[model samples]
Target: MVMWWLSSQPKGQRQVVVSILPSFICWHIWKARNKAVWEGISLSSGDICHGIIQDVVLAVSSEVNRWNLLPFFDQFFDRLSEPPMPLQCKIVRWRAAGTRIATLNTDGCSKGNPRASGGGGVLRDSEGRFLIGYSVCLGVSTSLLAEVLALLAGLRFCHQRGFTQVRVQSDSLVLVGILQCWFQCSWQIRREVFHIWQLAEDSGHFSHCFRETNTVADILANEGLLHPLVQMKIYNHPCMLPQLARGALRLDRSGFPSLQLLKRTPA
Candidate 1:
């Protein structure tokens, strides 16, 4: 019926008329399914086909009458009898082929080697838009676990938001190596770490960065150590670190071990 109506319409309008039927049928099926599922009713395949036919017939008849094109109805019906060769198609084309994706920075801080820990993540788009910031407290666990958790959360958040590519910056070289498949770690951390790595791989692209460049996430992780409700808020404020603040940031580099696991203040 839709093809018939389109054929009877002016040549210039045929494409526009034919293009609308696919969307209309898709919506019609969706609504029918919703009604059946939510309204405690069931429709058979025959019933669905009948409904579609009835709708198409009514629509075609109404349009013909409204446009005073009854004289062309036979030709329209003849056109409807033939299978439609769709000239328009909707394709899933990539809009951001070479465009860079948002960058995510993440870090973990533990008060003890296998005790109270905290993790945080920060996301910034290619245009430098602050997309999301999050921090969370982890129960008794290893620093490795905390690090892995931080990466997991960041990747999960990005995946949920449909981010195709990302650079995940972190302070843990061990974690980065593990993610890059350059090191052999424990089975426990390896399992979760592998999952996170796979998630990044399934997406378009991702990379790791050093802690020096991941200050925002580092601060958020440290702050999480002091507050449990920190994750509920989004930090949109500009991140800045003075000399002292930079010094205060803790991670095991060479001489400096993570302050969270240290027994006393550094001299």
Candidate 2:
């Protein structure tokens, strides 16, 4: 019956709904059973369905923009009582590190979540002179894991090369939050995060930057996808990077600005 119902869903929604429906139903059912057994409170069928909807909403809310692109989710959101949110544009620029300190920027890319992932990082002195850069091909990994591994590699390199008092930056807000203990660490990347903390504990300072500011690192991360599996390459000069990446590095050193338009979230 469940399979038949799932198959009956609209073609565009069948895959998405099928992926989540079983887990949602099973989880809610288990919770309801526990509640009834322990507290002697029974949930009606409508109540159980409501709980599932709420769970689904919460699960996908973080990536609302992406989900809203899908026809099914777009219509689902349109039916909500809340008004559609407006968009906001803001200026973003790359800023140099403080005098006498080195800045390390890192980024990760995945063709698809858990597919063809890679990590990369670049270190530069206060004057924006590139000191070192590295790219790693991470096989069959999630973007979050790639980000964590990239950060760990950068921190480890700094520690080994005696680059104390370094400024660590990445475009991944969740990664920066994890390093600062502002967000809960997921089990998947907890171990790598531990290693990152160990290397950066005393000498490193962490910050989250916009993608515009971390262009070089982002480029390097994408380039890693073409590298051999489990391979890591180090570059000491801008010329060692791809042509476009070299241009981005030159602009970054010359204080060029990149603009990013972001939507304002409702308070």
Candidate 3:
């Protein structure tokens, strides 16, 4: 029934709904099923539908523009149509590390949680010169897993290259907090993060930066999705060089993504 409703929307809106709605809806259904089986709890049809609608609205709000989604939002809330919220602008240009410490920026991408995903990282010297970088395709995984994977890849690369002094930067504040001893993580996260902290702990620092400041690494993550690596295959991946060259990946005069440069590219 929801699938039929999705098909009735304009192509642009339909695509957005298709990409986000199915997994979100299915996941909730699955969770509800699990509760029914394990905990003997049941939710009414109305309750489930309302929950799904809320989830869809929040998830799409981030990626879709406000004006483009006004009608869709109206459909959900009906007679009490909520005003579209203004977009928030918080990201700043990527900054360099101090002195001789190299800064590594990392990010993750996923089509869906437990779906096609990948991780990427960019290494730069304190002088802000781009050095080696990496992007790996993980066939399936949650985004948090992908986030940890990207951090692991970057930290391992630095360790192998004998980078004695380094600093790690990420847009995910949760990941940063875990590294900074602020919060405990899942056992899986605990294990992977231990290795990274060891690698960078001696002469390193972990910090949280806005996503706008992590542009180089963000492109690297998108590159991973665009061209997933296969085992035994040596890809002459540009490290997303083509995007950087064509202004598709976009960087400022200092070769970092800036607020002024973060326009939404049309599909």
Candidate 4:
């Protein structure tokens, strides 16, 4: 139906290639809808667009032999494949449960496989105010290792500080699974993965969060790479404090949970 409507619009042949954007978007959305209804496969807009990009590329690859399609395809694919930026005014934020239980958000960053990396975590109280933040350089490793290290750092911080009740949140779904003992981990992450749950004890309840809500910690994780190879623990590092403050204020006003676990299944 979408293609039929587009065909009847008197678009030129050049427009034919560019027109794949809307047509593929609608096609993927429709495909996603049917999957949700019958196949029980859930897809986000990102997922749908990714599928569309792959399908469109495959479909257009055949046309390259007949037409000078490289330039158009390269530009279009680059624009489409770029990572989606987080919202500037995103309401999804860290919320405090009460004055007692601190909320922890952890994140990690890596340059490449077996490259320079860092892990960081932030602690906030019930009022959505920063309590503590820390960043540690991991020398060189994969991002997954850094992410696991971040969680370990957060959990260890809570335990060492004698914080009685805390909620731990991380954007790494795999890390959360390891914390829950969902499956066996590879040897590289196996040791620290066990260390996280052990350190959590009774005070910590780990949950998976979306990256949007975990922005502040992300800053610390990336910032670690720039800092001298030393761990720093403080509420507001001068360079990153302003951004964290703005993020906190937005979340506080929006009244989103300090740590919201994004659920996959329909509630």
Candidate 5:
């Protein structure tokens, strides 16, 4: 109504009327809601919906009238009635020549100086099929150092397997940022991590994943402590290491890695 009124007046009157009208309506509604709430008056869902529709209609109508597009309101209403379909997410695969690329996920864990740590890597083809998994123990080290080592080992494994283009994934945000050149590492592990960065750069592509999305690598890392130096191979199936022996691997009171060798051999 304000916009229609402004359209009848001079062009200079449109902006002032449109701006003040919405502010006035918003203030009025806000004051009304507060008064009702303070007076112990409950608002129904219908009332809320009515208020929302009123606000939207007021804004849109004001803009349309100010622009003298009242005649197009019918077209806008028709379009709004049948909204466009949402876009679908499509997965794009990267292939070179005739071979598809590979994606690798790696993670590291330390239990106790060097800390008793383990690193894991999983290789998958472009079709998301598992190729192989690699996990190794780090005798002692910081978590960041373990992360760097894990990535380096993963990339090296991929390179050795003739993976020309590889996508690496990790749950370590710090390690991923450092590898992607998005964050700078402190002098503590800068020199040692440089080699890891170089390995990632040499690889085709890499990605950072949250821990939820990186459960495979996370499980492998923790399992590495149980089956240190043990490699299990499954034919035509995803391989998984058995659970860690109970009361075998213990963390020190200080929360460091403690090695208590169990009496079990890999079959």
Candidate 6:
């Protein structure tokens, strides 16, 4: 019935308008309806019509093959143009946790940002002796997703082992910010982040660290890429890790700090 109705409509611009109209119209209508109900906004017919047409034109015009197809396209493109920002580098140092507290450092590895991902974490005492560690293959995933999953696994380990007042650290600043409620989490990893929250409750303190300081966990994350899918391998001692990872663990145990060059953002 809908196809027949669309067929009867006048074909505009190689039938592209007709092809995109049905879905776009329905979508805009649903959005308008929600705005009216939830926000208590008065939706005038003219306003709704204008919005739908503007959105459709923008959507179509932005397509690579359809660039500047509409009169307003040039205006939209001009507004979006911006100059690239400059970057400066700064040094950051990693410090060990205070005595009597456990530290959990986690890292995520991915071949591509959204492909062939894995997560790993290491738990250590205040003296930096390895208590437990884990590495799990996540198949294909985004870097953020892998990070969130690794944090989740680490938190679960702490909770199950009756470890309290733990300090959680990760190389991903975004992941730490999400835990600190400084930013919203991506929808893809919202569930895992939420689970981490539940697991941590009041006992976990989350913080961001440089990747250089998280060497062992980073190595484990790379190792995760070779593990079986969804399978988590546990390490009770650093000897269970690869040679490079074991060496890094020893450095960490010695309280040796790692330095990182980080982008210095403008105030």
Best by lDDT: 2
lDDT (C-alpha) at residue 36 in model 2: 100
lDDT of 3 by residue, 1-267 (tens): 676555654445335665677787788888888889999999776666777777776666653444333334446534123344454444466676677878888888777888988777777777666666777776688888889888888788777778767788899888877777787787867788888777777423888887777776777776677665551112233343546622423353265545633444333
lDDT digits (tens) for residues 33-82 of candidate 6: 99999999978876666666677666545342323333453353343342
lDDT (0-100) at residue 29 of candidate 2? 94
Tens digit of per-residue lDDT, candidate 2, span 52-94: 7666666656445534333343355444434446666767767
- Estimate the TM-score of every prediction: 0.48, 0.65, 0.59, 0.58, 0.48, 0.62
What would the TM-score be for candidate 6 when compared with the true structure? 0.62
lDDT of 6: 0.75
What is the lDDT, from 0 to 100, of the residue 42 in candidate 1?
76
> What does candidate 5's lDDT look like per residue over 140-208, in tens digits?
787888787777777777677677467777778787777667788778878766766566565225566
Candidate 1 regions off by >4 Å?
1-99, 202-208, 229-267
Better of 1 and 3 by lDDT: 3
For each candidate, what is the lDDT? 0.60, 0.79, 0.68, 0.69, 0.58, 0.75
Task: Give me the runs in candidate 2 sitting further than 4 Å from their true place.
Answer: 1-88, 202-204, 264-267
Q: What is the Å distance of residue 71 in model 2 from its true position? A: 14
Which residues of candidate 6, in runs, are more than 4 Å off?
1-93, 262-267
What's the lDDT of the predicted structure labeled candidate 2?
Answer: 0.79
Clashing pairs in 6: none
Scored by lDDT, model 1 comes in at 0.60
- Name the 10 consecutive residues with the lowest summed lDDT in model 6: 76-85
Superposition error at 168 for model 6 (Å)? 0.2
